[model samples]
Target: MRSLIKIYRATADRVTGRNLDKAAARKQLRILEEIEFVCIGAVAFGLFLEMPSLCSAASLVAFGVLGEFVIHRFHVRASKREQNLSDKESNEQLAAIAEVNLKAETERLKRVEIEERRAPRRLSMEQFNIIESRLRAFAPVEIGVIPTAKGDAEPLEFAADLCVLFRKIGWLPAFATRIDHTIRLGLWVELSPNADRLAQRAAPELVVALRIAGIAVDQDVSRPAGGEFGGTGEEKERACGAGIILNVGLHPVTARGY
Candidate 1:
């Protein structure tokens, strides 16, 4: 009988696509065992009480088959439920990741828009040519333009004008924007430590010339701000070597300093 039971279990395991050691298979087997025991007890009682022997045997067989079917159905339902839950969890995780990526992309695009808005305006060809000619006469100074935050379009326009003017003069000028509390209006010259003696001497005359050209000028030459050129503060200072920084602000051009 034990050998027959083992054979039955092995066959059932293969048919049901489950291992007898697994939880689902073990649960089904336990329930089936209980049903078989109850059925056998009923048959034995019927025989001892002189009831119909055939009917008792038939009842035992029917109960055994029914129990097996019920347990199999239960296992199938449980497996399906577990699968659905797993799928739901996977979907939720994917949705969360996608949402985070979308938010990051949106923020990146927003930053790009702000930068585009802050970009400097272009200078016309005629204005470019004139400024270029004027800047060419002051070549070898390696000037840079730094616009103030509050200067609005005026500073940007001045920087653009300087770029074209300096480019025409055969000098590629560095251009950048910075925030300064003390600066309100006017164009100031910042001299680097390596600046030649001639540039230092010409600085005062350059300021006078700028003032005469309908531009407000800073009276004294100053040092470049920490990060006035580009990159980090130290990098900007290093880049400003032996060069002049032209700071453009919002104030209207006047006969004298603002």
Candidate 2:
């Protein structure tokens, strides 16, 4: 019953020159379709009256073919309208998705900028535990913590964190002392030429522990020039346990090809 009703309505629309699927087609295009229907009907009527001899047969056939042509044209134009509408909708959806992705990336960059403003140089308790276990045999070894002079506060804060990590593991790490040095970047563990076997073994372990804790420290190439850890005049820093000194230089570089 519903199909019959739809068929009846479609026929009625063609006879009355009504617009087809107004919501799916543009207003001007629908008006043009309606005008075509009216013109076809008028032309068919005029041909029927002018040819009285074959008006009932040949003229009727001509009108039927012209009616089919009009319906075919309407369907072709409606299909084009629907395809254009779908393409427009698809483009809008893609543009919206691109905007959302760009905004998320901008927010991520802002977060990175804020994180770079301050150094996240401290270790968590879990990191401390990992370092402590790695440096277990090196306990009771005294370590001298030294910060480079004319450096920013980040290195000092990093040195303080290092001292805390050592103290929690039963080691006597010295108070942080600042002095000028030729070294300008990164953390280092001192290993002078005169150091004994115990200091030699323990220094590398400390470096490994710090590296495991996500902190980069150098033990290799850390022996001072001329085998002496000296700097500006009258600067005498403490030394502990076979000359093991923790030198905190400038903050670890982020992008030196490291």
Candidate 3:
């Protein structure tokens, strides 16, 4: 039994980088152990009444406790190993995604490289003035900022609700999907005075929901200045673009913080 506990500790230490959240894990293990002891006691009480061998009943209880301890130790070790593997896989996936993103950026830069090279020296005065006029005519509009980690599910809910809101209210159909850990929502939503308000309110709700669901909410909120648009609309009424989210965890509710 001592050797088994040593093995369990070693396994956990190796897998969790020696930074295991001991408080949380120990709390959970203790709960399980308590439940096991209660069950074993009940069973022994019934057996002892039938057989009248107090010594044997006591030994049986000891065995039950030892068995439970072993199981508890193994369970903790297994969970840590699984978590370690999951973390490793997640890092690998992120690296692959970053590589792909870099390649795409390189391709885009190459396509615009020639145009950028020829841009400055050959431009006539009249052409430059026209470009400047166009730039000035483009109004800079502010969209609400979405803070990453404000809520656990903000990113997903905001994206889903945005897609729906954009399609129905703005009359622009948009697609929403998760790419890696990021949720990407792209489509044209008709610009209106209340668009910012709707986005701001919805974004925070999603973050809260994700936190409740036990999934870490951390991401950047980004919107491009210009995209494809179909028509204009009046700000007749305000609406919400809120998404749904929830929390999930293997740890007991009370032990989650640990």
Candidate 4:
């Protein structure tokens, strides 16, 4: 199919170069007609002279000329047919390509629409109750809800909601701190470099609490964010003895769990 198109294009280009588009191979047809006429006159003259040799020769030439005319006529028709076939098939191929491209673009637009409707990962009221009850065992622990910066607001919104919950639980700071840091993705647990055994012991329980409520926390326990913030707190009774940071990050395309 491809080769046929190529041949057709090349032939068309040559025809165009010689200005054959309008001429319709008329010149060649005229030349063949003239030759046939001359052959017919020769045969007639030979027969009038009563010469068998001349008559036979002229008769053979006339037949050959007739054959040439027929061959040329059919060749033109055949070429026309080939050109028409090429044109039709080429149009069909282009139409198919255009349709495929349009389908792909339509799919892309659908994905964009879905993304627009997609809501951020949320924590429900029942999950909140479960988490609050679980945290009661790790009360007095300090938590800094830090949400990472991203192009989309989904992470920020989710982080803000989670921050409100932690604040209401009385373990987090006033609000979530917005920081420009390139760190690990998804829900991560960050521990202070100076975090004592109390924070270490509470880390597993915290993971369980979040997971039990169906909140996906990705990592086990990562060290502090390169000492970006001090884990130490005010030394007093009921103060945060076990300090941990919940680094709220962008949601992953695929959800993972323990």
Best by TM-score: 2
- Score each candidate by Cα lDDT: 0.50, 0.55, 0.40, 0.53
Q: Candidate 1, residues 126-172: lDDT per residue as tens digits?
A: 64555444545555555556665634674576566767676666654
Off by over 4 Å in 2: 1-25, 32-58, 89-93, 96-104, 107-111, 192-197, 221-258
Looking at candidate 4, what is the lDDT of residue 151? 45
Query: lDDT score, residue 30, model 4?
Result: 58
lDDT by residue (tens digit), candidate 3, 191-254:
2223343333333333343234332333222432122122132222111112112111111222
Candidate 3 lDDT (Cα, 0 to 1): 0.40
1-258: candidate 2 lDDT, tens digit per residue: 334434444433342233334354666466656766765665676565565666565666566567658765876766566555555555555555656676787899999998866544555677778889987676766666766652455666666776898778776666545554454444556644544455556666766676677654434434443233332322222211112237222112311111
Name the regions of candidate 4 deviating beyond 4 angstroms. Answer: 1-117, 174-183, 221-258
Give the distance in Å from residue 40's predicted Cα in candidate 2 to where it truly belongs.
11
User: lDDT by residue for model 4 over 1-258, one digit each (tens)?
Assistant: 345445545543432213343234555445655765665665556556565586586776677667667766755664564455455456556656666676788899999888755745556788889888877665455555555453446666666666667667655332344444444344556554554555555556666687788765554333333323222323222101112237222111111210
Task: Give all candidate RMSDs, comma-separated.
Answer: 18.0, 13.9, 27.4, 12.8
Off by over 4 Å in 1: 1-135, 220-258
Residue 210 local lDDT, model 2: 64
Q: Model 1 residue 57 lDDT? A: 61
Model 3: weakest 10-residue lDDT segment is 242-251
TM-score, prediction 2: 0.59
How much is the lDDT of residue 196 in candidate 3?
47
